[model samples]
Target: DERLGLVQMAIDEHTWLASEAREGETVELLVKSHPHLSIVHFTLNGADDVLRYRKWCWSGPMFRMITMGRCGDTEAVVARACRDGADLDAGHFIMGPQMPDISSSAARSALAREDIAAAALLLHPEVLLWCREHKVWQASTEPLRRDERLKHTNRPSGTPQQPC
Candidate 1:
């Protein structure tokens, strides 16, 4: 029944659209708590709003989707970590609650991974409060947006994430 319950929760979570105020509040919380990372609640609706100062949060620079309720399992938990700032290449380092890589060689590998992630999540409760990000982006014909932040980063400096 636990798995079924999780499925239902995920369904419910995805059904709700995050509102502008809710998204701003989530960004504010993340910025206040995590100075090392950046936060952006990018969405189609806010595209015309100039990414108002409070609407975006970043300490120096860094940045997320998926709601907290859907984070019932480890993969989602780890995805949160990856979205927050924990690099997937960083290895088994704890991101919060812990667990899985299904393609692993052993049968129990997935379970073992899950337990680790779940434990990490429990260890750091704040991660649960971290904003759920729709990490994936949707593209449009809008002129390429520019940001000075990416000068040193791999992504093209002039184009933030839109079509040129």
Candidate 2:
């Protein structure tokens, strides 16, 4: 399996990427060998200076480079916006589980608690217990379960979070 392109990827010189479109089952791509490969994903809508096409819209609000050429008047602006966006990067990807959206009652109950984020790992009791045996989240100060017994005996260190 590959990244669904739900998150757009980056491509540079001599690089390529393929993904399924969000709208329907279709593949959209472009290939070119330019004297100067300044290729990047950009809005090709209303782009007349595009080397080959006047406009390209296989998927509305889509991304992926068409080709490399001089659209410095417009492409330059898009490139600058990309740069500004990068400069505003936060610690989002640094310290968090990168799990996909979980849509269960567990998500709601856990989120209702203010300190749930304090748990390094959020899992059901059985899973959390397994993690403990594997040396995961064994040293957190956040309670793993509402049942204090779940915290006391099975804890690998016999020292679970303080206030269960």
Q: What is the C-alpha lDDT of each candidate?
A: 0.31, 0.32
Over the stretch 1-164, how does candidate 1's per-residue lDDT look in tens digits?
12222223334445663332222466787889998995564332121121232212221222322112212344544454456664434322322322222221221232234343543343222221121111011122221122321222232122123311
RMSD of 1: 18.8
TM-score of 2: 0.16
| Alpha carbon deviation, residue 119, candidate 2 (Å) | 17
Instruction: Show pairs that collide, candidate 2.
Output: none
**What is the Cα-based lDDT of residue 145 in candidate 1?**
24
Looking at candidate 2, the ten consecutive residues that score lowest on lDDT are 88-97
